[model samples]
Target: MALPTHFDSLYIGGSWVKPIGGETSAVINPATEEVIGKAPVGTGADADAAIAAARDAFDHGPWPKMAWRERAGVLQQLHDALMTRKEEIVQLCVAEAGSIVPVASIMQFDMAMDGLQYYIHQIERREFVTPSSVSAHTNWATGGETLGSTVKVYEPLGVSVGITAYNYPFFLNLAKLGPALASGCTFILKPAPQTPLEALILGDIASEVGLPPGVFSIVTGGADVGEKLTTDPRVDQISFTGSDKIGAMIQAQAAPTLKRVTLELGGKSAMIVCEDADLEQAAFAGLINLTNQCGQGCVLQTRQLVHNAIKGQYIEMLKAMASQVKLGNPADPDTGMGPLISAAQRERVLAFIEQGKADGNTLVCGGTIPPGMDSGFFIEPTIFDCPNNSTAIAQEEIFGPVVCVIGFDTEEEAIAIANDSQYGLSGGVFSQDPGKAYRIGMKMRTGGVLINGGGGRLNPSVPFGGYKRSGIGREYGEEGLNEYLEIKVIDFRAA
Candidate 1:
């Protein structure tokens, strides 16, 4: 299962084509700091070509006109094709996205496949057409009588462009791709420049699965390429997963065309440890932000709101668990954590560590590069005991293996602290009483909440997104499928 050394072409119009500018960028292995490959760097011309192809496909393509079952058959073929190459895909993710084996295998690969399957299942059950009750009204003044029946039709929104983040390339791509394709929208993907290899491979998969021309395309490049796609009038919708700043920019860029936008932005989510919670389980679950994808996940609970009753014991357990996490090469099967996406990302996390120090937060452990790990963008799992939830470390998304432990005096205080941030993406509440946990979870101003780790599983059937500034629109489940669809009402009159 050797990975491809180079991705030298963009996949557009269901064919492998060279970039219009003929420029390429080196793909670096974040864990090793070595050039793993060179991916084609697309430009505005490339984006225009992709968007045009997608527009043409949506305008006059068999895919959108095909029966839902027929489309499901094609998606089923894609899922099987991806499954056959799962191992190779995981390895490529490790090389390209700095994802450790478990994270790459489970979070990046398996979860994506599951999401695609969920969409396929939904396609079978979803009814795109709904009939309304027929009514009759008479105007006495004109002596006019009318009887009519109306039907609401959900149709594809035409061409959709998905701009994904670097942390979970494959997962995020499918998070957007599954819904767009399931709802019969032609898709164009612009992956993060740092991790385009896996996405290029996805293009290969889509081509091999016999996806119709213009139904799918992948154009890889920097922000300029994204701007081209967002500003273009032909693209009917934009699904972007990245920082809030960039999400705002994309929203603004798409305003003139009035294209629909679904933004899955950043999060500074919290984990509340209730006074009656299981301290051991709570501590282990709290380490998820530090271990999984090295805390690069937007929804990872980076803010820990522990009750003052068990704060000391919980902090000690967290320290012990954090220390045991093995950080090194992502390819290692036993490694619990890996490096940040790049040196720049490592520097950013380090700067936040310094800021935490300046803000007078207690540095519990790990604030520097790990010993004997100098060749890669590796940082030790850093933890802070903050006085309040107002510190920079507690509020902003660090996107690295950093956690802030904030003490709360009561349950009400915990809920207030968790909802006190600008972000409301995901959070968790741990308690011995299920009713208590549910009560607190419902009060939190976030989109998703986990009780007792929700058995440490992610259900694709559940809608995943954010509230407030965290994001707009949702992904996964029926809500995700609706994002790519537009409604049309038809009225029929009988004489």
Candidate 2:
């Protein structure tokens, strides 16, 4: 398929319209750091228009009044349309964001489709505008005679702003938007500049699937645009996924206006490899999970807390497995990994590695850019033997393919090291002892924990969010849908 080089304007109110003052950003293909395409650069005014449109739809337009069956039908149609264009979506993601083709095709696309389908499946289970349950018909009081009343209500939270990170654009969007849509809220989606094409394509597909005017919109730009979207009071809620630093800024700015905010922020997750674990299998799986998506994923387990007795063996196996990560063009079907999002990102990762060295960590495997792929924003699948939980490499979210190995003496110490972080999102434990693994997973204080190979189902039927600054609200479940709803108790006198 021949890729288009540019999109003229933001998609809004069911139409591609010109912004009052729109700019443009050249979307770079990280694999080559080459400007492959351009996305519309939206300003505050653009955000204003999109937000207003969304607000109108969510509050007073057809979307708010649309029956649940209609919304479900549209959602299913969108799902089918997206399914038909799965290959194209993968291609665009690979080109726009340096996403690995195999992973994008296998995990990202299919899972997004699954989430959409799940949302469709939910329409049957939902009862719009439910009333409070009542058993006794007569008025009753404890000691004194009193009148009984009933309550019933539910409605949309007006417009919502959705901001996605560089990794898993489709997956995250569905997780955020699906529930909002189910609640009858309209959306203004801002895909990461690194991967806006897929989102733009998502909006287009949604439109084709007969999503109503002003029901869904997309404005693509960089930080400035994101700030405008988050700051606008017309936006009922801001759902963001990215760094902690940025999430803080959003929270601070949003506080004055008291915007409803949900931030899925940064993490330096720990992968605990216990004594009785399959060292080789664990090591290889760990390497893949850490380095996948070029380590752009915020939940990527960048820290490995290994047992002292088997630390050396785990390190050796991890080194060999890290060597197997082949980074190249995203178009290559066999490529397991790709490049970072930009030259600046690659430099940042390198600086972190240097800081690790200064902090007295040993470079076990890849420390430099891979031998031959020097032109692109490429960093090796690097690992450092820091062994100290507080080391710079061990604690910081490198946001690159860099893993730090730390040795723990006992089970208590391993759990201690795992919990010693400001952010807790996702974690994994590898132990032959299922009981121990389960116990550790429970005690580890994260949104999700895996006994062995931790995986994110993100089923639309299941809730997903993090704790302690990882995020404010859950997504992809019944609870997620409620975030977009306002509960009202209609007092009905029961005589």
Candidate 3:
């Protein structure tokens, strides 16, 4: 596939625009360490323009005033447009982000389409206003009885900024954009510098779809652009997906304006393998997902908690599976994993591996760069036997293809270890006894739990968020839409 070397302009206020800044950022291909594309670096002026445009749209444009069905129709058109470009988008994602073909096609491409379509479906059947039951209340001013009725209405929260991660750029953008736009909120999208090309394509599609000017915008830059969007009072809300470190910064920046923020941050999720569990299935599932997106995902189960009795057997199964995984070119159908977003990210993961080794944790198979494939920012699928749960490698969120197997004596210990971390995004349990697994899952402190290998996969119809530092608000489904809406209550009394 031929990649565009230069996107000469950024998309703002529904138009192809020249960025205020002359500097540009190169979008490097992690697989080959080549500059696949370059996006015009956005400046504070660019962010101001985008935010002002969104604010204008929300305050006075036709988008917020349009009926629910009218907005739903536009969402349907956007969904159709995305469906038509499925192949091109998938190929672009693979080229720019080093997403292995199989995973990219489903996650970065197909699921994004599904998410937009899900929002469209939601609004098509949605009720914008609901009537509350009538009740009688004392009229204090008149000193008389009054019969009253109330109606509740949902309204958009004005301008929203979506700061997405590099791992799943397109999906995260759509995850926030689709619902926010569908809910009548004007939006400014800021894609991560590591993978910004595909998101730039989204701006093209939005324009081609004839979305109202100033209703949607995409700004491409580093932390400064994001900071400008977060601190500016014009931006009414922020939906961010990335590390906890940045999420905290966003929360702090939005504090002065009290902007509503929905954050999907990092996770050190656990996959508990019980004594009676299908050892091979549970272990393999955990390992495969651990390397999914080269372990860039926030929701993957990185902490494998196996009962002490079956730890050896489970570790062996993971090793066997890890050996068979092909880790070369992402375009190859047989390749199971790909490089991290950049050399910097690969080094970060490698540093964590070195730390694990220094801590005397058992290195179970990977943990080094694969032989002969030295050009790409690649790290082997690494695992460690971390006996102490308090160890840095065991406790921290190493956003890479690394897993730690912590042995637990009982279900209580397994739950305790899983919930011990500050993160509470998603978790899973494996056991032959469904009831036992269910009981354990219920006790977990995480926001979402899987019983018998049932979670981790995205279900657009349900809510997805975290507890503790994992995140503040939910994304996907009705919960996601609600994040962009505000409630208003109106009372009617007999006159």
Candidate 4:
């Protein structure tokens, strides 16, 4: 499939329109350090137009008034359209997000499709209204009266905006898109400037599927676009996925409007290897940070807390595992790891590595750029042996192919170290004994915990989110569907 040429236009109000400023940003492929595409740079005027379109749709369009089954039919069509373009989506992700082929095939594309299907199923089976039991009440004006019943109605929250990050463009876009549309809300997607092609393609699909005007729109730009979307009172909700720092900014900006905001922010997650855990399984699990999107994922377990009893052997095994990671072009099928999203990101990660060294953390292996790879934004699968968890490397989110190994004396201490961070996203506990792993996982403050690899899969049926500063609301599952809905109760009087 050939790539679309509409990258120069913004998808607003169900039409391909030129940006008001007519500016464009170069989309660089991290692997080759070359311009792969140019995306339209939307201005604040563009954002306002998109918001007005969505608001108009919610107030006067047919989408919110459609029957649940009718909405499901449209969602199913979207799923089919996306599946037919799977190969193209995978290629775009590899080129634009620096996602290696295999990871792009699954995490970037397949998972997103599955998430869409999940929402489709939800639309078909979910009840929008439910009745409550009758109640008796005493009225001062009239005698005692019996109320017939009450019904709780779940209605759409109106116009919603999704500000996505670059790491998982397709998945994050649909993560907000699916639920919002499924719940009968008009959605506006503001994809990250680094990768906007997938979102533009989505707008094309929405058009192909005959999604009503203003039901969906895609506006691509920098922080200015984001500010307009978040602060606009016309937008009833904002769902953002990015760094905690930026998430905090969006939350503050949306405060005046009191928009319903759902933030899936950054994480410094920990993976604990108990004393009685399987050494081989635990060691391989440590590679998740390096191989999964080059550690750009918010939920990747970047912090490894190894029991002191086997800390030395475990570090050796982890170093060996990290050594074997093949870093090269993300287009290469055999490549195990890919480059950071951009040169600026590479420099930011390198600065963290230097700080780690200055803070007295021992460099285990793989810190500098790989030999012979001169052009791309590649970094080695770096690992550090931290003297303590208080160091900058161990505490801050590097968002690169780097991991920190911290030693712990007991399971209690391991839990303490893991819970000590401000982030509480996802966690992992490895142990031969399921009961033991469950016990340790229960004590962690994160939203979700994986035991012994979670079979190396993600369950879309399960809710994904975080605790504390990691994020505010959940994504995926029924709870995610509910995020875009508002509740209302209607009371009736007995005849």
Instruction: Give the per-residue lDDT of model 2 (tens digit) for 1-495.
Output: 343557867898889986667567788888877777777877767777887788777667887777888878778777777777777777877877778886787667887777777766776567756666544443454454445566657777878888888877877777677777867789989888777777776666777778788889988866777888877778778888888888899898788888888888888888899999988868976787667889888777888899989999888988887787778988888787888888888899999999999999998877788878867788888888885888778878889998988999888898999999887888889999999999989889788787788554444577777777677777777777777787887776554
Ranking by TM-score: 4, 3, 1, 2
- Each model's TM-score? 0.97, 0.94, 0.98, 0.98
TM-score of 3: 0.98
Root-mean-square deviation of candidate 2:
2.3
- Per-residue lDDT of model 3, residues 442-488, tens digit only: 99989898887685457899989999999998988799899999999
Write one digit per residue (lDDT tens) for candidate 4, span 1-495.
575834789999999999999998888889998988888999999999999999999999999999998999999999998899899889999988999998899988888888989999988988889989887787667876656788999998899999999998988998899999999999999999888887888877889899999999999988898999999999999999999999999999999999999999999999999889899889898887656898899999999999989989999998888888888998999899988998999999999999999999999998899999998899999989987899998889999988998999988999999998999998999999999999999999999998998866677787999999999998999899889999999988865
Instruction: Kindly report which residue stretches of model 3 are placed more than 4 angstroms away from their true locations once superposed.
Output: 1-5
Clashing pairs in 3: none
lDDT for position 330 in model 4: 87
Give per-residue CA lDDT, model 1, range 421-466, as digits (tens): 9999999999999999999999999999999887566689988999
- The TM-score measured for candidate 1 stands at 0.97
lDDT of 3 at 102: 77
* Every candidate's CA RMSD: 1.4, 2.3, 1.4, 1.1
* TM-score of candidate 2 versus the correct structure, residues matched by position: 0.94
Of models 1 and 2, which has the larger TM-score?
Answer: 1
Q: Order candidates by lDDT, high to low.
A: 1, 4, 3, 2
- Per-residue lDDT of 191 in model 4: 92
